[model samples]
Target: MFACQVEVVVLTCEPLTMGEERYYAAEIVLKSDFVNGRVGLQVSLEDLDEWERCLDALEAEAGAEWPTGGRSAWLAVVPEDPVEVTVHDSPSTQIAVRMPIDVASDWLEENRLRLDRVQKAVATVS
Candidate 1:
């Protein structure tokens, strides 16, 4: 298959309640050289699950704290050139949002549930 590098800049999940519909919506800013510079992608519960699967693989292959080459996020994919992706997505039915799904998931798991989120709720303005 194609070899590419993947990393996640940010991952966030917010509890949403709209009438009877309630769910946790998420946003993931997956950073990769293969696709755009910083691809801000959205994620749902299913997406988060998908990402966790990738994270599991990374943990199994590498340690929990994977080397980031002194970078903030871990290296999601191992190798690839962005140019090739551009070529493959050209012409009819041609478009690519080259986000490494697994990497985003790993980022989510790594950054999910923090201590600071337990702080007091925001106060309403008078």
Candidate 2:
């Protein structure tokens, strides 16, 4: 029997006058051979346009090449079927990405390209 699983880990950094507060949120889903592993991550933001802008800024800062622009970053994993995206009213903005456990290493490596930019951005605020 084939076994597969998917999980999502979100790391959010909020900057303050003195320092930054980082929040980590995670969700795990498992599937057996009979079922295909599926996972979705919801990113909440006060404004949809702002959320897109934030993601665009992140991509531009990272200078990482994406075939479909920054879509890969948030989708993380290209599902066989369309994944639903929900926008809601919230005080803070968030960006969520989902991926399969087996390819977690690959995802990490792909994302690591933005480490320098992320660090730089955080440093500027702190």
Candidate 3:
């Protein structure tokens, strides 16, 4: 059992250019009773779909790690009785936060819908 409550919010998805390369950025904000942080995740349409697949195939002993496209920050999901969401930010110092939330019947569907919305938003950003 965990004592913290975690909430992840996707603020927006926008196109970003670094030098000559382009990528879609997802502004992810994570909040919990123990910690709060934000990250700009560089992802493609395929990445979003991959995440959906990860969520779909998640199991109690088999967890999933999100592709953060960074070495310092990372996110993972652990499927227990109460799903555990953990985010680690270690640009200079390590700050790892974990929280557990009850998995309602619609939780997975809700997450898939959120990912679909993000994919659409990314596709429309020109």
Candidate 4:
């Protein structure tokens, strides 16, 4: 059993197109700071399929009994393995975390009422 508490200050959700396929994914910026900036984690392109699969499961259930139910379902979709975290331009500076999806879902649920920060960052970055 492993978990790490991380503060997601902003998320960059964007559409990725590859030939005939399009994926909607997000890059989360952690509040964990470095000398110059904060550490970031990108939801890998392959994981976009996982996100869609989780969404499909939600639809198949015909909606959740409560909002958090939906979030937990999504969290449960994460593979039970350590996810790679890397710092750009620093190939040797790599790290990993377990239960990333559960952590992210928990954060989202906690801050469900304050999505304006994420939305604003997405708009500005896009």
Candidate 5:
């Protein structure tokens, strides 16, 4: 069976000011039989929130790309028939891998749950 897993590890976070804004340092990990890529980048809460929205509203022609502008190592999900997941390294590395996975019908729900866990984890950071 093919497998694709994405994980976001919030290594540390700092308050941007005396407000709710935070500077989050996170590592995005994508793993499968064909790819094992990790990208470390700075993210805002909006980035994570937007990711959730993307997954929720995913469609064949409307795929999702994290970190939006390829500013760093990024991942994109192309929701074709089998759901293609692509992992790309920053321009310096220039390495990319794409693989199709046979996911359950509730894959989006599962991913949303995983992201929710990450969100909760980030909330506890000091």
Candidate 6:
């Protein structure tokens, strides 16, 4: 089993469509010990329906599809083995998603360009 750790830094809801609706956007970070790399994933949606649509887009973009048709307030990439997600009821909800290294690697490869751009922008601002 490939060991990995995943964390979500931010999940923000913004008004869209002339303030008629709200969208959810999140920033996810994955780190692996098996591989010397890290990945940051981001997604945005205009509403629950739009979130589901965005998730579909994500699957297609990643080239690994899932057969689920619903809107999820939050989702995480987890390992094939048994895993658990703990959510802390705090001001900023904290969730922990555990996945295998291989899965993490695949996600990183799929989002390399976007992740690299985010990292570069962060570096420039720092």
The estimated TM-scores of all candidates read: 0.32, 0.27, 0.72, 0.30, 0.70, 0.24
Query: What lDDT tens digits, residue by residue, belong to model 3 across residues 5-96?
Result: 34543335678877766667665576666556676656666666778777776733578877645543556778787778776664635766
Per-residue lDDT of model 4, residues 4-91, tens digit only: 4442233345654556654445443444433223333334344433444444554344222111222211222232323222223222
Q: Go through the candidates in order and give the clash count of each.
A: 5, 0, 0, 0, 0, 1
lDDT of 6 at 21: 36
Question: What lDDT tens digits, residue by residue, belong to model 6 across residues 28-125?
Answer: 33344422322222233323334344345544543222112333323433323332222122223343343433335454344444444544544453
Model 4: CA > 4 A from native: 1-6, 33-93, 97-126
List the global CA lDDT of all models. Answer: 0.34, 0.32, 0.64, 0.35, 0.65, 0.34
Candidate 4, position 19, lDDT: 63
Q: What is candidate 5's local distance difference test score?
A: 0.65
When superposed on Cα atoms, how far off is each prediction in RMSD? 11.5, 15.2, 3.9, 10.8, 4.9, 15.2
* Model 2 clashing residue pairs (backbone): none
Best by lDDT: 5
Worst 10 residues of 2 by lDDT: 81-90
Tens-place lDDT digits, model 1, residues 50-106: 444544654455323222222222223422222122111223233334343333333
Rank the candidate models, highest lDDT first: 5, 3, 4, 1, 6, 2
Ranking by TM-score: 3, 5, 1, 4, 2, 6
- Which ten residues in a row are the worst by lDDT in model 4? 64-73
Candidate 3: pairs in clash: none
lDDT for residue 64 in candidate 6, whole number 0-100: 23
Better of 3 and 5 by lDDT: 5
For residue 6, give model 5's deviation from the true position in Å.
Answer: 14
